[model samples]
Target: MQTDVPVTDRTRVRREPARGRYDRETVHGIIDAALLCHVAFRDGDSVFCIPTVCWREDGHLYIHGSNGSRMLRALLGGQQACVTVTHLDGLVLARAAFNHSMNYRSVVVLGAFEAVPDDRKAASLDRLMDHLAPGRKHEARPGDANELRSTTVLRIALDEASAKLRTGGPQDDEADLSLDVWAGVLPLAVHALPPVPEPGITRSMPDGLRKWAGA
Candidate 1:
């Protein structure tokens, strides 16, 4: 369903019907589930979609890469970009082959991206680390001044976006209801295995990581 919110001229067709979410909740969930997002944008006459790690804070998304990278440079120059996140949930098999589709959740966001200032780099890096592994940043070595200067971070405001989702069993035609087939949704999921520990065994391990040691 498409929402009443006026669609951005660039993504009007792809925009799902707005239903009060402004697609924020749905978009946030997909973004949190995966660290990598594909950002699409045009540089001059060429369109590019690059995959990179990102984090969400307040109502904005932060994406990072090398300062010298072309994509990062273009985005830093205030180019319009479309960032997308998707997760495949299951395979929906219908009674008839024609109506088969996969269960999925996806979100697409459009924004004019810009680079974060050097003064804000430290806080941004901390947020990025926590996004990847909560509490892990405090356990690792702090970033040296030189290392921080080499990275480029772009910020994209979380407005002007839409989300599309499909779920449940497949939609089969009435005429094909009698066909003999296993017609249902085959569920799929992701589960995290315990972490692996390093070889040295001298000091007591943190209680938070007990499971990783087979405890």
Candidate 2:
């Protein structure tokens, strides 16, 4: 059983405290369901927020990028960083315009990142491959020493994270119930399109691709 991360000032959802959840289940669920995260960090006198691919491995959220990337370099300084992931599930239409809002699941993590050692980087990155597509690591060619050397892998513990979510339909005022405007939810999701094969490839779609395509 995973314990809930204690909420800190940074991870606290001030706008609507009722929507915030500090449970591990909610945080992990939001992280696992997302393919992208925006990392916010301070650099010199300025702050930067960068979008990158991310994956969850046990108690950590992992991210990788070129060694030359400024964002990655900035995160390695042991400074506290903020990472956020959001999924827009739907648009809640209300009879009153003021009551209109978006249905979304969002997570906020506040922690300092640490670099994965050279020896552990490969194995750590394998988790990312497995997360993206099971069995894909076996089908894909392994990265060479130079390739690995040019990449940087970092992770932050999920010890100070919180999740905020809004679900269900619109909440219109009783007075607005008689309004002429339509009121309902417009649901949304990330759809996976069919795969496109390489022109010169003689191989058929692999099992992993088939699974990704919902075959």
CA-only RMSD, every prediction: 3.9, 2.3
Q: List the residue pairs that clash in candidate 2.
A: none
List candidate 1 segments past 4 Å from native.
1-21, 201-215
The whole-model lDDT of each prediction reads 0.75, 0.88
The sequence of per-residue lDDT tens digits that candidate 2 reaches over residues 117-213 is: 9999999888888878788888889888999999999999999998999998999989989989989999988776866778998787776644445
Q: Encode model 1's per-residue lDDT on 62-117: one tens digit a residue.
A: 89888899898888778778998777889999988788888877767888897789
For candidate 2, the lDDT comes to 0.88
Predict model 1's lDDT versus the native: 0.75
Q: Where is model 2 poorest over a 10-residue stretch in terms of lDDT?
A: 206-215
TM-score, one value per model: 0.84, 0.94
